[model samples]
Target: MKAFQLVSPGKTELRDVDVPEPGPGQVLLKVTGSGVCHSDLHLLHAQQLPFPMTLGHEPAGQIVALGPQVNGWATGQHAICYIVWGCGVCRRCATGAENACERFPRGLVPGPGLGYPGAMAEYMLAPARSLVPLGDLDPVDSAPLADAGLTPYHAIDRSRELLTPTSTAVVIGVGGLGHLAVQILRAITESTVIAVDLDQEKLTAARGHGADHAVLSGPEAVPEILELTHGRGADVVLDFVGVTPTLSVGAGVVSSYGHLTVLGLGGGSVDFSASGPPQGLPWGATVSRPYGGTRRDLHEVLSLAQRGLIKVQVERHPLAAADDVLARLERGEVRGRAVLVP
Candidate 1:
């Protein structure tokens, strides 16, 4: 098997490697499509990950081998691999909150492509529980649904209880996840959806996805959101970028008792002061950081995809082009998710 190995920051090479066999409760997948995400760029360039590993994680493929103790699945089954492989016995896992599982979290330790050989190769092994069957959808597009779609789904679903037809939902940073957030909000609720971004192209894509309004992020953004909401502010604001500016904007435009969900890992922070609302704003803002989705959430996303209710925009790249894909993603040149084909 040939794989792209990230030996260290600023370096990645394609090399022939031994194909891994599935252990107990695991399965080996013949790699079909793997999405190159922004996080992969961060991991590679920022050296946020340990060296000498494969990087692709958002994968969709067909099962070629199954390990002992795995049941209710078979070889040749097409599936989208769930990125978060959690310890099944954890309390969070037991309650379908595996995204928050405290024990044996997959992403925390790094495996395949990160800590282990990732899907950038011809073959990859994953826990059977991580595979979600994709019966009819194309694997290339479905690849992003694993994280780009699932992350926003979990983030938005957390605030679903607060969203209403009369409420306003603002998505900050209308990029990969932000664009999907707009569509998800449109499909699931009647809330007025506002898309915010520094890029006009992304904002236009947001409108195509279902945003009622797309506002450029700057001095005018707050006033624009306020005006759109008739001075009430947004009922739920999801900051997909999680940068200082976006978080500040989210906190600034939230209505009283509104919820703000931050989904980006940009490492930016915002402060909530006790001083009387600046500029006469009266809202109380809470920032909730959401990571990947739980198994159930992934299932829900797959169901939506199966029903053609959600669509993913992706640029396909060959496994050999992993480095170029990462370069483009790091420079923010990719408009949508980038899927690597083996």
Candidate 2:
């Protein structure tokens, strides 16, 4: 199988590697679709892991083989890989919190394309436990729903209780996750959604997807968001871009008792002052960073896609064009999501 592997930091090699076979409780998926997440660049640059590592995490395809002890799964079944593999008996895994797998600390993150060899090649080996039925959804487009969709879904799930008809939700950095966040908020709740982005194109995309208001992120962003909410500010701020500028905008526009959930890896940080939050936040407001979604989150996110309630915009490329796709993503040329089809 030919794979696009990170032979070294900043260098990718398209080389042939042995296709893997499934072990007990595992399944082998024929590589169909894989998403190039922005975080993949961070993973490549961090070099925290070994060289020759595969870098895709969002994947979906059809099962071609199943190992022993794996029941109720058949070959040729269309499924989306869950992306998080956890110890079967652990409490976290028992409740579909595999993203927080206990075995993770032991260097086991059976999520193919990360700790495990990825679907960037012709074949992928993953745990049968990670397979979710894709049903009639296009496997290629559904790949981003696993991460880009699920990430915001998990963030919104936490603040769902706070969203009322009178509430306002602000989404900063309406790119991949940000654009999806807009749709998710509109689909599941009654809160008015506001999207902010430096790129006017993305802001336009956000509005087309269902954001009630879209603002060009800049010095005037805070005031515009405040105006949109009639000076009360946003009930929840989802910052998909974690740089200082966006974070500052997020802090400035979030209402009191609001929640600021930062999900970007832009290598930026915020310094909390003596006051609870940066600006308009009330005494009870909070800020947090949520990780990837749980298994249930994936299922729900996929269901949203299956029902046509949410859709991911993607630029498709052949597996051989992985390098070009990553470069375009880093340059922000790829809109919404980029999927590598093998």
Candidate 3:
């Protein structure tokens, strides 16, 4: 099998490697497509992890082999690979919150892409529990639904109640996740959708996707949101880019009783002090950080994709072009999710 391996600082080289066999309780998938996520940029650029790291998690493929003790699934069955492989007996895993599994707190096992080999190669070894049946959807197109779509789905699912018809929902950062967030909000709720972004192209993409209003994210953004909401501010804010500026804008434009969900791993923080966005953290307004969607959330997202209620914009590249794709993503040149095909 061939894979793009991260060998040194901020570099990746395509090389041939031994195809991994499915161990007991595991399944081997012949990789069809894998999404190159923005989050992968941070890790691949740092190169702080061990050498020869395989760096893709969002994958959809067909099952080719199953190990001992694996049943109920057959070869040639298509499935979406669930990224967070959790310990089944843990409380979080029992409830489908694999991202919050207790094993991570105990240093028991790392996630598939973090420590184990990822899905960028021609073959992927996944736990039996990590495979979700990808019914009629194309594996190449459905790849982004695992992370780019699932992340926003989890955030919106957490803040669904606040997104009523009378409410104004603002999505900051109209990139991969932001684009999907716009579609999800449009399909599920009647809230007025406002998208904010630095790039005019992305903002235009947002409007075409479903945003009622697309505004440049800057000093003019909060005022426009306030005007759109008639000075009440937005009732729901999904900030996919969690930088200090975006967080300030997100917190500043949130209504007193609204919910602000920050899903980006930009390492930005919010202070509940006098100098923060709002004068005082008054009323029931809250800032919440969710890691990713639960297993059930991904299932629901995939179902939405299957029914064609939502569509993701992706640029497909050959698996050998992983390095070029990474550079494009790092330079912020890719418009939407980039899928790598084997």
Candidate 4:
């Protein structure tokens, strides 16, 4: 099988490698679609990941083989694969908190392309526990739901209690996760959604995904959000960018009892105030760092796609063009999510 192997930072190649067979409790999948996420670039360039890795996590494909002891699943079944491979007996995994499992470094999530060979090739292996049947949705579109969709789903679910019909929800940075956040908020809740980003293209996409208003982050962006909320500020602010400026914008526009969820891994910080006037807005703020979603969250996202409530916007690139896709993603040139067709 042909695979893109990240031999080291600043180096990757399309080389023929032996097809990986599923281990116990795992399954082998025929590669169909793998989304090129920003984290892949982080692993490629940031020196944060181990060397000689595969770099895709968001994957959707059909099962071709199953390991021993795996039941209730079979070959030829279309499935959207989960990247996390938790130890099923751990306290976190037992309580459905596999994302918090401590047995594996940086938690149990496979990191797909990071730790193990991911879906960038003709064949990949995954735990049968991570497979969710894709009954009616297109595999290309469902690929992003594996992470881009699931991350925001978990983030918003944490603050679902505050996102009431009368309250406001602000999504900062309408990129991969932010775009899906817009649609998820609209489809699942009645909160008035506001999207903030520096790119007009992404903002337009956000509006198309059901954001009631899209504001460009700048000198007047906060005032626009303030005006949209009738000066009370947003009730829930989700910062998918997690940059200093974006975090500042989110902090500037949240209401007193609002919740702020940060999903980006850009490595930035935000200062919070408990009393007195806030820095950007007139309210108290709390920051939440949500990892990837749980198994249940992944199931809900898949079900939502199966029901036609949400759509994944994708740009398909041939598997050989993986380097070019990564370049474009790093340069912020791709719109929506980019999926690799193997």
lDDT of each: 0.83, 0.86, 0.86, 0.85
Question: Which tens-of-lDDT digit does each residue in 1-342 have in candidate 1?
Answer: 988878888788998889887899999999898888777766777556666777787888899999999998999999998787666687887876766777754446343455566788888999888788998999677888988889889988888888889999999988778778888899889999999999999999999988999999998999999999999899899987877888888878888888888888788887866677765335566667777878889899999888988888888888888888788887889887888998
Query: Candidate 4: misplaced stretches above 4 Å?
Result: 48-50, 104-108, 273-275, 279-284
Order the candidates by TM-score, highest first — what do you get?
2, 4, 3, 1
Q: lDDT-based ranking, best first?
A: 3, 2, 4, 1
| Candidate 3 residue-wise lDDT, 11-85, digit = tens | 787889999988999999999889998778777667467777887878888999999999899999999977777
lDDT, candidate 1, equals: 0.83
Write the residue-wise lDDT of candidate 4 on 62-148 in tens digits. Answer: 999999999999899999887777777898788666787768755436557858888888889888888899997887767889999
TM-score, one value per model:
0.94, 0.95, 0.95, 0.95
- Candidate 2 on 1-342: residue-level lDDT in tens? 888788887788888889888899988888788988988887667555677877688888889999889998999988988877777778888999887778775554557667678778878888888888999999788888878998999999989998888899999988888889999999999999999998988988998999988899899998998888899888899999899888888888777778989999887776576654333346676899877889899989988888899999988999999988888989999899999998
Candidates 1 and 2 compared: the better one by lDDT is: 2
Error of 3 at 119 (Å): 0.9
At residue 102, candidate 3 shows an lDDT of 86
* CA error at residue 123 for candidate 1, angstroms: 1.1
- Residue 62's lDDT within candidate 2 is 89
TM-score of 4: 0.95
Clashes of each: 9, 1, 0, 1
| Residue 52, model 3: Cα distance from true site in angstroms | 2.4
